[model samples]
Target chain A: MKQRLVSPVRMVWLLGALLIVCILASFTLGHYPVPLGQLLGILGSRLGLPIEVSWTPQMETAVWNIRLPRVLMSVLVGACLAGAGASYQGIFQNPMASPDILGASAGAGFGAALSILIGLSSVGIMVAAFAASLATVALVFTVSRHAKGDRVLGLVLSGIMVSSLFQSATSFIKLVADPNNKLPQITYWLMGSLSGAKWSEIGFILPPMLAGLIPLLLMRWQLNVVTMGDDEARAMGVNAPRIRLWTVLCSTLVTAAAVSVSGMIGWVGLVIPHMTRRLLGADYRCLMPGSMLGGGIFLLVVDNVSRNATTAGIPIGILTAFIGAPFFLWLITGKGDHYEH
Target chain B: MSIEVSHLSFSYGQRQVLHDISFQVRQGEFLSILGPNGVGKSTLFRCVLGLLSGYTGQVLIHGTDARSFSVREAAKHIAYIPQSSRPIFNYSVSNIVLMGRSGSLSTFQTPSKADEERCAWALEKVGIPHLARRCYHRLSGGEQQLVLIARALVQDAPILMLDEPTANLDFGNQLLVLEQAKSLTRDGYTVIQTTHHPEQSYLFSDRILALQNGRILTQGAPSQVLTEQTMAQLYGAAVTVVSLYQDKVRVCVPKHITIQEEAK
Candidate 1:
């Protein structure tokens, strides 16, 4: 067992294979079950693989246009949340920090809520949600920019303030919303399902996700320095303040995009980074990518459970909350108590 | 190697902390700063290190303005050992010392084999090579302080800045670390350290600087700066300074009344 303790490197490769298996399983076994070979044939047909390409047009549409995009969206959003979470944790020097506390996810939720309450179109609603999340993070960044020392503390306080302001604004919109039509739409969106995903939404999400994740991958080493304290970081020749500002901007944007599309997928961000930290140690070079992969696989499993729950379509967020709440309590009370007050 | 500070004055907003603090140390000299509490010793060092800017007058290192240097560039020439015990984690002793090398390395490079060797050499020099593998927090307060010094040693800069390097040490570690710092000056490394122990400063330092009220009261050889009149003026107490062994060493005993109270 001791010898089997996989380094983050080996574990990442292992998780990659497991994710592939789960992805294949989830795609094959959804409602109106496509056979594994037929699903493979359809996927192979799309990629120009030489085969008879067995499924009908409607089956092909369901598998390729619907299931595939939804799964891909889950993977993308999951990886983004976990990566953003780890980045936030490193920036704040607090293990409990995640994008939710930093106003990215809640900001998006409030934005979408406002749009639904105001009777906007689908694309307009998505844009509203994305913009609101971005705006909230920007507000937090601006307010906390001048705080002397403890930039993370400045961020959390400002984020909570912004979240509350937007949340109240959303409540006001809901109070005035058309209860007959708008309210149900708002609540349904808030429940958060990949059923709403499409190729265009995926298009909007991928750029910000890639834009943020790539830089985080490259600069993971620098994040390690800043976590040790900015003065200590500057003493070591790193321009800690500049690095922090850039990272906060990138991470905020990615988390905002994820939340805009996925409706505040809880626990992936909080749990993934903590799990990565425990499994991988504190080295960001390993932890950053490890969190990303682990988050993708974890979300895939949860999404699979949501699809297969007994005659009830479970909200993936609720599943995460169920798993996350206990794990969070354990984190606070268990071995990770060093992070808490 | 030569450090020259000309008429340096600093303040936090309206309240001045260091005023007209002028002093110089020739290349490869070991100097100790001694003063009563709240005498701006740390403030003076911070000015020289350029951590606190907007101070009047110029601090010139090798005839260049200290203010002109970036934090990294300044750190490249000077290694600062701030007072320790601020860390909450159990970073290893060797790892802590190896952090001294960070300023010199590029952004992407991890600590190299040579850096590890320097860390080893520094730990060995401080006579705690065995403790190199131990967790920093698990060590005694004295050992922890020495580990901090070992970090400074590995920095390999020409000038070492220490803030009360022995404040928490046991008597033996105090003498040990000070002797090690004194020996550094022999190899052409300049040392500027603050100390409450005037006797040890007199024993190990080439010069002593006395500061009070955000200004330098006196700075010269130990004989000139550690005089009875200067001690009385700086500390604002009636102090008796005694010399022995052909005036090679001076000791500052409490003003007899304080000593009496200690006996009681």
Candidate 2:
């Protein structure tokens, strides 16, 4: 079927422009608002520009210290998670595959909770989460390697088993944690938030995120060949297993990095890629970048609503589901057979 | 020989699927492999294509051992059209055809503009230029088979291996797909295919290799290899072979249906 949607090129430009607008508008939101001009002036001053500081110190602090890191974290985490999700979906040949399909998010959540109970520093918690996430994926692979039948199905099943294992471990930690301090912290962390965004945390996730994202972006075309299935891939001279390994490694790296910092922001990874596919079609050359931009825009808008919709900021994880589910439903049911082909 | 398999044998764990199968296809020849289900036709193709590495024998493609070649090098020697199945994602027809150029691309490389134009040319050559922008999964069974042929054509290999290209197609589409494959042999392409219909081999193939239980039951020209007794032994059914068009065409008709009708 010929898709009548906006062309892939223009849709990419549209998503990019929308992401920029959302990022700018997010700076204007929150408990302490920074107007657009002062935001630009603050950015210019930071960039060694000759713009005068006509705004107050609090606006500067809000734009530079508070909002900048949080905005960047949201965009990066959003892009990484959604990009990972899209890659996972392609490599696994399952539309239901997501960034968290291989237990990364659950393992990271457990790691963060365990560290919170141990009273570790925030950086330690991030490191612990990252390690635990990777460990979970490694364990899944080892387990699947031993299992018989289809390797992809084996990996997916092992992912489910291991993810639930970690989920129960986190629950046990929650049960034994100190109710007043560690309990609330763990619970809030599990719910997910970008409120604690810091420059150091950004630095920590950046290298791994770039390491993960750059390869995925570069290998997007190969991802298309891989979706034709393993036997077909091998016959066509695209090394399916090697491509699958690299894809899993890179996507897992990105997922682990995003989850370590952002707690458990869930729906953006799973839903944003599908939404981008609806708009841009299933070509990964476009879908990869499209998911990144669509995810950044989606999560940025959700984060804006999270921090600004109420006097007490809502946790982003909650807002993502609240907003993401309905919007995704509308995209699916409202459209006339967008995915039917 | 364009392709040769020497004493190729494969097994899964304790059970062997293909047992010392041997065959050859000469240059510009259309060879049809006929067999029933579970006869290891697909396993043989996989062995030849290097998808199965544990097989015991050598598959030489144009004097080079098929196993010695890397995946890309294998693609240069042979193009494959796998059985048509619905893919998870609905890729555009042009995009699916474009993937045939992937053997020439590096790990991080995409199909260039030249590759895209070649993809278009292959589409035109396959007579599916009108469906270039259509979704692959939305096409009819025959149309999907043609799209896959277009993809194989884009690979630009001298030898083509098709695994039951007409399995799920209607009668007209079956003839259409077989016609396309048969015509390619005229253009100096070595085409090897597997089929369930014995009559199709009679009509289109230069040689027939019949398999029974992973063993070569018979091989040669269709007339000699497709007698009533051989057909019955191969498929374990009562059948009769008859000539048509003043002995120019031959067909196998199962006798059980007529006997049951006469009894009724």
Quote model 2's iRMS.
2.1
Reference-based lDDT, residue B79, model 2: 90
**Candidate 1's residue-wise lDDT over A1-341, tens digit each?**
12225655677778778888878888767576777898999999889988895678998998888888888888888888899899888787777788777688767878999878767788888888899899888888888887676776887888888888877777777778788988777777776766657999999888988998888887776777677677666655666777777888879878888888888688889898887776655557677888888888888778878887745768888889898889877765764412110
Cα displacement (angstroms), candidate 1, residue B53, comes to 1.1
Tell me the RMSD of model 1 versus the true structure: 4.0
Overall lDDT per candidate, in order of appearance: 0.79, 0.89
Error of model 1, residue A173, in angstroms? 1.6
The clash count of every prediction, one per candidate, is 0, 0
Give the alpha carbon lDDT tens digit for every residue of B1-264 in model 2.
Answer: 998899998998898898888888999999999989999999898889888889998899999998899999998888999878577876888889988999889989989999999989888877888988888877899999998988888888999999999889999999999999998899999999999988888899999999999989999988887788789888987876878997568877779776786799
State how far residue A158 of model 1 sits from its true place (Å): 2.3
Say which candidate scores most in DockQ: 2
Candidate 2 CAPRI level: medium
Worst 10 residues of 1 chain B by lDDT: B83-92
Scoring model 1 with DockQ, what do you get? 0.30
Residue A128 of model 1 has an lDDT of: 88
Candidate 2, position A262, lDDT: 90
